[model samples]
Target: MNSRRATIADVAREAGVSPSTASVVFSGKTPVSDATRARVLDAAAALGYTGPDPLAASLRRGRSGIVGVLQRGPLGIAFTDPVQRTTMDGLADAVASVDASLLLLRPVPGGPAGDSGTAPGPATGAATLATVPLDAAVLIGTIPEAAADVAALRARGVPVVVIEGDAGEGVPRIGLDNHDAERCLAEHVRRLGHTDVAIVTLRSELNVTHDRLGGARDVFPDAPAFATLASSIDEGLRVGRQVFAAGRPTAVLAQSDLLAAGVIRAAEEAGLSVPGDVSVAGFDGVPVDGLAPYELTTMVQPAVEKGRAAGAAVVAMLLGEQPASVTFTSVFRAGNTTGPVPESRGVSPR
Candidate 1:
């Protein structure tokens, strides 16, 4: 049996029209009379031709319609983290206007810096982000993991955008006021009469972690700091257990909502009453599933807007249009999870 995919030319022949005429009917780039369009549709239906191959079309246009997004950690985490997922959702919405799709580029451990591959070992030069046929690229968190790839991309003239982090100058940035937001959250704790505080943080190197921690320290310079591998509930719980074990601080500042929730769980498990015996706060005002009765005092960053901005930046740069880097501010929310430090848990009075 000779089975071959039908092409636009074949549909044109079957419809008794020239190939260009048939192509126009499908592309809708040029107007075709209803009679001719109907003829082309009928012929396409008969031939099982579901329009032109998208890849082929993009290739002919010298574009891939694919944007490279550096997956920060496990791909699963992206779906689970509200900030990551919401950002991606926004990115998808923005890219849809240009008919673009995202390719999550996972970093390869033990591979040269900036190599976006699945595993350590030889990565095909073509498989690298720089050589890959992507219209543009966006770094998820920071650029350190993919700095070399970014350089290669720049050399190749591929547009690059970094979300929530810095990649030196000239790269379009989708930034948030992390330092200011952190300061806001920490100041709230200070106003609540919480002097002795513990800070739970995400990965230490992340810009989010740095800014949030800096903001808190600006208020509580001597506050003890604990770091987690990721902004996750389990990590929060783990570090929460450790922090509480060391002697409960009057208040705790967690870097993300998920981490904050974990710390809350730890406090509860340790028989500490939240805001009663201990006050806990978090950043990234995301919903904490099942952490009821405790609306967290947090900073709500624009996760979705950040993603959309990154996607839009890519579109702009690809079109030879330079877009100014954008910075967004986070609003502080006074949720139920925090309160004045109990006199019993605070520092010894002089």
Candidate 2:
């Protein structure tokens, strides 16, 4: 036996069958007899052969057989966000059924955004993504500057799919009805007879701002003055503290539950009662930050479904099929966080 890895010829010889038969058994591109299949399996087991090397096979097919997921920032942080993780999981599940691989590409170090363009090594961040030859690429989380890169990829004729961001010119988009979800929350607040509502908002875009409260007014004019900040419970807490300190509104609609929870904490710190002095609502309806006592009034978007759709779109594009774009609506869940305005201001005091 050669010290080198077992090849298809070796498996065929061990199985006492023709090389083509063994190839058919492995590739499943052609059918073979059950007896032949059993023999091939037995031979592969005896020879400690894990079938043909995928890399070699991919090279032979003139394809990488891997889907590159271009994501911004550190891999760890991207996976930490519940929504992100769930979407990735859904994507993996969608690809796993067809035995496709998911390759996570982070910002290349000094490569483009922050990293340099020079290649350091095989694993040198963005260089790995830039140089890697892939069948297709999924721009995860809407790469703003992806138009050029996507155009380059398009030049190579690779199909691109975007998740939760603008897909640029020809790339397909997968996202929820963010504007509608916000409108739903706004309408809910409006119906509660609260007009002078303040907002704690997440940064609208990564490059543009750090936090946003009123800036969302660009998107929602009916919305109240918002405090723009990073989407986190701490940011929420800070915004909540300020609102409470500066004579808070009757009800506050936070961009995320993490922020809303922080607002609740701020309210507690200020000796203000929730729904008693100020009511609050949030987005992304997922339960985080140990929030239990105050059931948040939120819009529950199907985050996992969003991810699954993106993954499915990738699969479809790979198959040379036109996949349709998907948009999901968030269900408005009214909870303890929202109620009617106080008698002192029984009418909406806008």
lDDT per model vs. reference: 0.85, 0.73
Model 2's TM-score against the true structure: 0.78
Write the residue-wise lDDT of candidate 2 on 1-350 in tens digits. Answer: 46988888889999999989998898899988899999999998888888789888887877677777877656764566666677788888887755677887755554443332113343434344456777777776544555555765676777788886776766778867666677677777777777777777666554212223333343446654555446678888887888877775888878777788899999889887888878888888887857777899988878788778877887888788988877777788988988888868668634
Q: Each candidate: how many clashes? A: 0, 16
lDDT (Cα, tens digit) per residue for candidate 1, span 130-167: 44678888887674655666777777778889988887
Question: Candidate 2: lDDT over CA atoms?
Answer: 0.73
Best by TM-score: 1
Give the distance in Å from residue 244's predicted Cα in candidate 1 to where it truly belongs: 1.0
Which segments of candidate 1 are over 4 A away from where they belong?
1-4, 15-48, 112-120, 123-126, 143-145, 347-350
TM-score of each: 0.89, 0.78
Error at 82, model 2, angstroms: 2.2
- Please tell me which predicted candidate would have the highest lDDT against the true structure: 1
Candidate 1 least-lDDT 10 residues:
117-126
